[model samples]
Target: AIAEAIFRHLAPRATPLAGRHALVTAGPTHEPIDPVRYLANRSSGRQGYEIAGALAALGARVTLVSGPVDLPAPPGVALRRVETASQMLAACRDALPADIAVCAAAVADWRVAQEATRKIKKAQGAPPPVLALVPNPDILAELSTPGPDRPALVVGFAAETDSVAQHAAAKRARKGCDWIVANDVRPETGIMGGMENEVILITADGAEQWPRMDKRAVATHLAGRIAAFFTAQRSIA
Candidate 1:
């Protein structure tokens, strides 16, 4: 903590995000199907972790609510780890009353309606088990809802396989978030588990396509934009 403070103090740019709290959600939720197995995704939590670090560098008090991932917590950021979507939502609620929120986790859309306590054995001649699925909570929409606890700026991510910009724009409207970072995560793009990313930043104004760059670079750029957002708000106030 002391080292982080000193680094922030010596940083070249003024800490525009100082005195603000930022909440970030990262990684992929694991929906348990049985004691030995679970459903999950390919998210490595790199982008979100980088964003947390970048926000802390800008002097924001960051709380990273993460799902199961192998990455370590970012320096000077509080980390809350969870396994399932429900747990992730709870952690996010606990970190609320924040000034900024970035929902970068690729949460599972569904979970087994009834998770088996024991793994089902595959019978030699029987049909495979049919798993019933249920919708998981929409964390982004919940955070974006109009309320006192809602962050001033809420950013959501859209990992689309097709019609990236159009789908992301629709998601922004549907979720009522301030912005959406949309990216094509087609397997061929190597983005889901890769170090680099190319995203389209969708805002109420319009969509801005960013060049492919390292994930850390994307985080830094986004943090700069966030700082500018608060600066502009302060001026208007």
Candidate 2:
């Protein structure tokens, strides 16, 4: 009670998401190649984590399913930590019946077919061992698919190096998600791990291009848009 009161006193803004539930995925999943080796990306989880905070500020019960990232958990948000794509998918399933779902994690496309129980050592003169890869579970697609437990709003992210809008639009349709926040992460852009982002929010109606801004601002804007969506839905229903 004291904590809640303190939080409210700090910012007495209206919480449009009051009594709602939100689920978010963040960070980069680690696909183990060996006991000491793993495949991962440079996703800092900044945007997603900030999104979770934004949603919490709007009075939503936020559950953040995150991977390995060097950041503290957002206050007033429940954090579920996992290391693998499969674990991430399982965590999302366990936190179902959400009002909104954001699939923002940079999950690896594949993992080693077989995980070695012991550490792999380099042979003095022999060739390196071969590693077979298999596709990882598609968490976004699973939740976006039509189902009784599907969230009212499903959002995904696409970090592309080329044809950002085109690829993100195609991905939105392919993944069956309502919105896809697309951004370019080419080497020159410095957006993959940077604090600022220039994103295009692709939806069924059309693409809404957002100007370059801090990730926190983007999250707050997106959260406000989400609140408007729910408000509109309630009116329609």
lDDT of 2 by residue, 180-213 (tens): 9999999799888899988999999999999999
| C-alpha RMSD values across all candidates | 1.4, 2.0
Q: Model 1, residue 142: displacement in angstroms?
A: 0.3
**Model 2: residues with Cα > 4 Å off, grouped in runs:** 1-13
Best by lDDT: 1
TM-score of 1: 0.96
Q: In model 1, where is the ten-residue run with the lowest total lDDT?
A: 4-13
Backbone clash numbers for all candidates listed? 0, 0
